[model samples]
Target chain A: MCTCNKKNEYIPYPAKIESVKKESFDTKTFRVRFTDKNLAESFQYKQGQFMEVSILGVGEAPISITSSPSRKGFLEFNIRATGKVTDAIHALKKGDALYLRGPYGNSFPLEELKGKNLYFIAGGIGLAPLRSLINMVMDNRDDFKHVKILYGAKTPADMCFADELEVWKKIPDTEVWLTVDKPCDAWGCSIGVVTELWKETDVHPENAVAIVCGPAIMIKFVTLALKKSGFAGKDIIMTLERYMKCGIGKCGHCNIAGKFVCTDGPVFSYEQVKAFPEKEHVI
Target chain B: MSKMIEKKKIKGLLKEAVKQWHTYVPQKHIGGDVLIAPLPEEAKELEAALDNISLADDDLVISPKDIFFPQLETMFKFKKGEIAETVESSPKLLFGIKSCDLKGILFADEFFKRDFEDAYYLSRANERLIVVIGCINPPRPGACFCTSAKTGPFAEKGFDLQLVDNGESYFVETGSEKGEEFVAKYSGFFQDESGDAEKAVNSIKAKAEKAVELKIEFQKALDLMANDDFIPEEKYKRIGERCVYCGACVYTCPTCTCFNVFDNAKGDEGTRVRIWDACIFEGYTREASGHNPRNQKWLMACRRYEHKLKYDKAKTNMSGCVGCGRCLASCPVDIGMSKFVQEITEDKKIM
Candidate 1:
């Protein structure tokens, strides 16, 4: 019986954007800290969880927590200027106060992936959520073995976290592979989809887990590719996106069959996702 | 101890009740439709309104769920970027509620208070008292299936007080401490029930249960939905093509709690509002980037029934439908949960 007064769950906490890093032409990573010092210190969240970011007079959108909890500083949100709320968020400068509620939804299974081969597959802005776990794993590199990152974008300019990707490439026992659908003159990566990175690197699914996030089609294909490369249904993990109002389960917008993506998941194994009654609609 | 009240003295008791609680009762509108609405505060208006008070078993056009979860609600008001949550409520008395509708309220009670408490609903619901009037006959004999759904014609629990119609007198059975306190507070209006009152109430309950004529294979349908690989895509397509997307079913449904939130701003000042949203709507599940997984008409149609029958039951152990027949009664297309259940269970196509 938790007696915490949850009456104000809908009301968001005011947070200030400490800094903004341009991820791409349309996406920006905001470094936010809560205005309340106590809240800033107490706030904790796992990788793959999301927050309901609100801009006054605009609206709220679900953005994944791109920063790792292990960092213990400002929280980061990789937001693309696509929706009305994101557009308003994009207009904000440093020191601008926005509102946030929740470090909601289930996070990536961290304890299970320990000491196992880790494969991070992402596409375009989908890399935002995976970056949280990627950085966490990088900080404690001894816990995992053979880290591989397979990322793809539409073009060279669409690639996000380029500096961080470079930093990750230099990590020992880690493989960072990048690809672009349409390469620029300065581009020096493979020119293909993210799944094509398997050709350039070893992708044995033995004692390994492939974490994937992307557009629905990309996830579908990636899951197929992972399975084709001898990955079991439970070995492939993916994060999903949906139109969510309440990051809690009440606002039934994010349900895929019986499971609410907001509460039951935003992260589910391919095994669990494959069993959804409306798997066709979800995947 | 149970008490009894003369059928004729209800109006007088209600008038006296208005001073203490914001009482709601079923009243007939000018258009001849009966609805559960708030009693007027003014004495003159109250008298005239009570004169039209309907105690009939006829279904209300709108369920009493609106009293707690309004179709549209203001979550918070913001001026100059500061939020002021509008959480205010007063003590209320919901009188003459049917068993099915009362069950709907009980179900909603669990939903709004589950993992996260919805302040707007709880503030009102927590302070309210429920007095359910058991129906002697099915409100909509052709549509009501409470017995099949195991929700009515009388609620087994969750009401503060229950009124069993006993010819000239009504037997008042207290269900909770609130009901006991209410009886104590208004002791003059109530009298001790005769020994025959219990036997009479039992007989009435049996009769009411038998009165429900519409009995779809509700349990079988639930089993089929839960156990079988029941993907009736073609059936959904037919129903979807016929559906006008009018949202009458979800609007009138007592258990449908899905809502959409948006900010209404006129400049620096605005309010964040949440309104009832139907799962069948195309834009309900559509992403901001123009991607929609449940985009097709059939898919939206599937989501609604599956949510009510399969998902909600799996999650809450309570089926979303209370068998009030409001969805079928309010629908223009004649597609309702009962009809869908019949269609699936009987292996027949619905026109």
Candidate 2:
């Protein structure tokens, strides 16, 4: 309705929070739909792509789309209250209006993973982006050979999607493993870093692709573990996190080497990531 | 045959130009620095004006980049919950810009239009015409190195009109259709050369190219930096140690287009604006979770050079450095791209 794309990519469309669910102390999951019904219906995004979420007079931040396209009524964002824009977004109640501009960046290679074993590895809020792909894989369960989700958090309370985890565990032939760095009295799951779960699960590189999303340090160790587990660089996929302004790549803040993360990727195979000169800075 | 205009008629041309479009020319500021600025709205006699209007003789401390990609520009305005787009543009003429600065504009044009078009920059760029004045002598002799960068003493393309000074008059050549139209419209100011001006123009161009005394191994430096593992951490640390983080290089650079967006608000009404940003700052790459990839000063220094010499060349097939030498002129510390290239290829220390 606003014709934001035609007029200016910087001009964002108004959207309202349909609902808000507290995922953690600093994180909240918001279900948002465009204020314009037609625009909402037309908006489409893939698993790992992100949107530039704006809070009118505050600012904007890049938040990954957490909702799967298969369940496409509304978009969801799991935002952490870490900076000016995100803090302002966290303060907003249900039905509060905000602005959105993207669905920018490349998404996961879902086509290549068809009929192949899928391994999803995430830590803390890292699970947010991978959740989009995980749910899509679940919806079309028959299309995939196997599904394994290894998620971890700093603490039991920091773990997100607690109820959904139970639902996913009940899905036939799908495996969901969650761990916590600091477990509570009621906790019954394994405790340690995510790599510790490598011993418990049978993660084979043969005919399987491993998708990982987490903090840089966690990603580094996960990449090493995956490599040691006989996974090739091309078989290990990871999503990156960077401070970015314009999600359309005009803003050079997200640039590394000759690649712009906003355009070239938020998702890249380990083989590609290895080729970046400043890969150490990334993961 | 090319047109020619006497050096004495420059004031008259500018005076006439202001009447037609938003005209920018190098004017001496009260601080004694020359900057490219728009003519005052109120009409004034050019000869009688106290403000010294520099015409191809003085160094303009600031390039003409700010005319299109300003230091700060408002993207949109919002009141309460309602949002609106606020893009505005008007026809403009940039007169007496140096050749290096024109090349910078051309590079910026590609950068802003690549992949996704930036409406703000493209809108302003579409309404603009460039008039470059070729340098007969290096304006900043100590810092200017347009010869090695291969972008100047006179631009080969992208200018609307290029003027080469031949002492008594200027040999005018059109690089675009807009330039031809401009010459036809302002035929009174520009006239057919009275004599064989090609010889004079060629001689002046040679003299101007020779006046740029500073040269660096720009190509070899690019080749050295081509290897991703050529991490000159020690060199970067040395340069970073001397850097004041003043952001003078980026601000003065014609090709440094990185910007940070924020909102300026009062009560419920507010405007979102993007301001020029430097990558050397720690906050430029710092994430929301307090993690920074380029947190170190040396890393920041590396990024700045790698962007200009390495990444830009690989991506756009153009070096980001125009060899305008504003970086050295503006830097409190003498860390210019020419010096950096020298350090990379010749093993000379910048500091």
* Overall local distance difference test of candidate 1: 0.89
**What DockQ, between 0 and 1, does each candidate earn?**
0.50, 0.56
iRMSD per model?
3.6, 3.2
Which candidate has the highest TM-score of all?
2
- Model 2 segments more than 4 A misplaced: A1-6, A278-280, B45-51
TM-score of chain B of each: 0.96, 0.95
Residue B89, model 2: Cα distance from true site in angstroms: 1.5
DockQ for the candidate 2 complex? 0.56
Candidate 2 per-residue lDDT over residues A74-179, each given as its tens digit: 9999999998999999999998998998889999999999989989999999999999998998999998988889998999989888888888889988899988
lDDT for each residue of candidate 1 in B301-347, tens digit (9 for 90 to 100):
87788888887788788888899998888889898888988999999
Give one digit per residue, the lDDT tens place, for model 1 in A1-283.
Answer: 1122564688898999999999898999999999999999999999999999998789999999999988986899999999889999999999999899998999999999999999999999999999999999998899999999999999989999999999999999998999999999999889999888888998889999999999998898889889999999999999999988899888889988777899888999999998876534677
Which pairs clash in the backbone of model 1? none
**Model 2, range B263-327, lDDT digits (tens) per residue?**
99998899999999998887888888899877788788778898898889888888888999999
TM-score of model number 2, chain B: 0.95
